[model samples]
Target chain A: MTERFDFEGNAWVLGDNIALDGELMELKYALARETDPEILRHQIFRGLDPTLAERIRPGDIVVTGRRFAHGNPHIQGLIGLRGAGVGLVCESIHSGSFRCAINAGLPFLPRCPGVTALVKPGDRLRVDFATGALQNVTRGERHQFDPLPAELRRIVSNGGWLPTFRQRLAQQN
Target chain B: MGQTLAQKILSRIVGRSVEIGEIIMPEAELVTVHDWYAANAARALDEVGVTELFDPARVMFTTDHEPVAVSPHAAERQQRVREIAARLGIGHFFDVGRGGQGHVFPVELGYIRPGMYIAGYDTHVTNFGAVGALGIAVLTEVSELMALGSVWQQVPQTVRINLHGQLPAGISIRDVAQKIIGELDPDLIDDAVVEFAGPGLRHIGIDGRFTLVNTPTELGARSAIVEPDEIVRAYLADRVDGPVELPRSDPDAPFRAVIEWDMALMEPQVAAPPRPDRVVGVSQVSGTRIDHAYIGSCASGMIEDMRETARFLKGRVIHPRVRLFVTPATNRVAAQMAEESLTGIIQASGAVLTPPGCGVCAGGRIGPVAPGEVSIGTGTRNDPGRLGAHDAQLYIASPATVAAAAITGEICDPRGLDPDLQPREAAHD
Candidate 1:
């Protein structure tokens, strides 16, 4: 299947040190044993910002700074974002968070300088992920980086590694 | 081109010589998860419509975090995890008491072997590095590990840390770990594989090396390893269930950097409140009063640490103002403490010996730090507001240092307390 690397979304801006266990996702839920993806999809970022619970739309983009999702290494929050069709483009990310975003099939740009400066909480961004081109229509700024390789593009296209891995297992069998 | 230990292991796993910066696929000999992620991992498997795992026997599930299942929610979570493990036909499931901390339990139970590749869900999975396994904390990506049975990898640039000399009286690996945190905080450590070597490494044992492994994960290390030697061979000769293989870095291996330290120069150290990396010599922070003295957590809750705490507090009672909490890391260790009478001596010194679990060190699930309270803890991290109360202050130190602080109701140097507890042999780092 050919993957769609281009996306148009409304950007949501957050700051650095958004903890993986608590702020991005509730540790209590991981502790409380809440695993149903639907319940989790709505609860994402509720603790970070109450409006995030309701304001998030399908295919929205997230903009944040270094150490984004820094603490505790829980990825249920990323799962929620993937379920909601979100894209993450940040100044930098905790390596753990970077892997989770890719694994969860939430297309991400791991490092983008001046991301927060160029986009606000609700700005339209026409992103050509194939070329790493990001256009912030509101501020009239253009940003880009090196795009992912073909192998990674295939993994992301399959909605992260798990599905692709399952297909390989089936194919081999 | 000489290969670092990490490169050697990855090369073996990938069936080819691997280079730094290359992305490769390497399947772990095993993938592990604790109670927090087990049930969720099961649900995710069902969500993806996959019933068969890549290999069921290789997946391990254990319970360590909040083992008591104190709340109804916690109990329910544990129950769900067990049910899912059964449904998945997982061969290695350690429920409640059977498994302590997944990281150390694997080492103690002989599940981890030298040069083996292991992926785990929790951060402290780095603990397996004590036994010379390439145990990486897959964290959020464990879901994929569960489904794919493979871990994605970037062949990390490795830095060798050469430890030299003796750990002088009153010094321990906790101080060494804190020092690594402070010094290895730069880009040199982030995403880099760390290997500990040098003559002083022979002084440390498996349990002591656990302290060093615990510190590197806090710094974003892929793995913190000490190549297994005679000390490890002797430790594993009778303990491991299967044959073991030892992999080492070549004598002239290419390295990102090599760090050398003399242990004799280290004094009793304390990590100042609010962050584990903000370290200072114990004397600099001595006399600062504390309300709580906690001696447990995956980082320092091993028998070695508890024995040191017991030996130091044998004849003396802690200050009346101090509420000292001593929780064992594992039930086996708790039983061993009983057999050795370490529990009796420690509790007699006014410290409460609770059941084995990760408590305040995890977040006040058991003995919480009250708001406005100042505490000295031996947990892995002391991030602000982590231990229940955001307003409370927590200083990180070794168990022996904590025992000293408990006696004085204030931060004090363990070196000055008593010459009675002479330092013993250490483990590999």
Candidate 2:
């Protein structure tokens, strides 16, 4: 399978300290241990923007400020975003959320400092998650940030930790 | 190029020197899962087509949560957990009533030691830091470790917190920990391992250090540890059979930041609802009425905390309006309380004694606060719906403050209570 490193989409700008449990996704869904992306996608961002889930298109990018997905590193939010075919570029993220993003197979740029100032909501943005090159197609601006480390990118590219674990098991067999 | 405690520990695990921000897959020395998550881990293992663990001997399972089968459904879950443990060939299986809290008993039983890299399914596994072991909370990722024998981890920088002076009367380490987390900038501690140092280490015992290490993850810290010294050595001497190695950082170790705090100036602290970091001095929220009071969890259910609560409630009775529940973190702690006669004093003071386990702090599974009620206790978190009802309010503090609240039926400073006051009847307002 080929790993696509580039992503293009419209930006969905969010502020700092967007919590995982109460804000990005509700606590009930996570507590229910619901992993079905179709069900989760409808509930994503319902706390912050009720209509945003319906408006999100495939390949849409979420641009967030520092401390994205700050509280309780539940991966339902990341799974929902990935299910919707959206990518994320945050100014910064907690270590637990960073691990969840990789494990959920969500394409993310976790350390794009000052990224919120680079693009406006609804702007067309193109990102190379492998090379850390972010292009603001709407404004024709270019920016650079550190890419995911090779060790972690491999897990995301393999469609999360489970698939990677399966592959490792197969190799062992 | 001196290495912090975190760097040194990770380097030893991987058999090579590691740098901060570098990802490494080092085999864990010990891994633990409690009853609450054991089923989830079993299901994940089945989904991954794993029939056996990479090394079953290294894995442990304990029935710390729901220890007494609160309901028929809980009974069924416990039965299934036993079956799963048997099926998986887990080496160390502490069934209900055997191990108290998975975090606390491991140290008591000497399963945890200095310079060890361990993993657990629960966040408060940071309690192992009391003995100088780096216990990282892997959440549901424990399944990956069980199957593959290792999981990826990025080395984190270390933050040095230096404490000085001695704590004034009635100020427990929990208060000091709450204040430290409230004041430390989240950015500096985020994704960093906090290393507790300075002269204050001599003043705090193992149980107090557990409270200090257990609270930092709420602020996004990767993990926390204390530099193992004679205190740790003395505590582990009788518990461990083999030679124990105590790890410390180099004098010039590179720390992201250093924070110095004087315990003499510290005051009793209360973490208000909505978040654990919303800490304020006790004077700020005194006299607020409460419906319930709890004093247990991995955070404060140790023997020392029990002694402190007993000391305050010796001859006093709790307010009639408040339902105070005292839970020991482990059965051993309960036994100690009974042997020392603290249990009778606590129960005689009108405080109900629950079974030794996670108690109400485990999502209020055992003792829950009803709607429109307020509670004060030593639980780790006070998030909405944390203790029972979504509308219920929980204020967290040290055991002494909680005892004071139980007596007055409201939040009050423990220091303000008269030590010589006589036992009185339940207050009727």
Top DockQ model: 2
Q: What's the CA error at residue B186 for candidate 2, in Å?
A: 1.9
Q: Write down the RMSD of candidate 1 (Cα, Å).
A: 5.3
Stretch of 10 with least lDDT, candidate 1 chain B: B420-429
Separately for all candidates shown, the number of backbone clashes (residues 3 or more apart, or on different chains) is 7, 0
Q: Give one digit per residue, the lDDT tens place, for model 1 in B1-429.
A: 789888988899989999887888898888988877887777767766767777889999887777788889999998898888888788799888776777777787778888888888877777888988888887645666776787678788888889998687768888888877876644467677788889988999988888887888776777788877778878888887666778899988889889897777457778887778788889899899999889988889899988989977886789988999998888778888999999889988888987776756767777788899999989888877778788899899999899989988899878766545443311110
Error of 1 at B383 (Å): 2.7
Against the correct fold, how does model 2 do in TM-score? 0.97
lDDT winner among the candidates? 2
Query: Candidate 2 residues A1-173, lDDT tens each?
Result: 33477889899999998988878899898889888888888888888989989999988899999998888888899899888888899999877888888988888999988889989999999999998999999999999999999999999999887788888889988
What DockQ do you compute for every candidate structure?
Answer: 0.20, 0.75
Candidate 2 structure quality by residue, lDDT tens digits, B107-182: 9998999999999899888889999999888987799888878889998899998889878866789999999888
- The Cα RMSD across the true interface for model 2 is 1.1
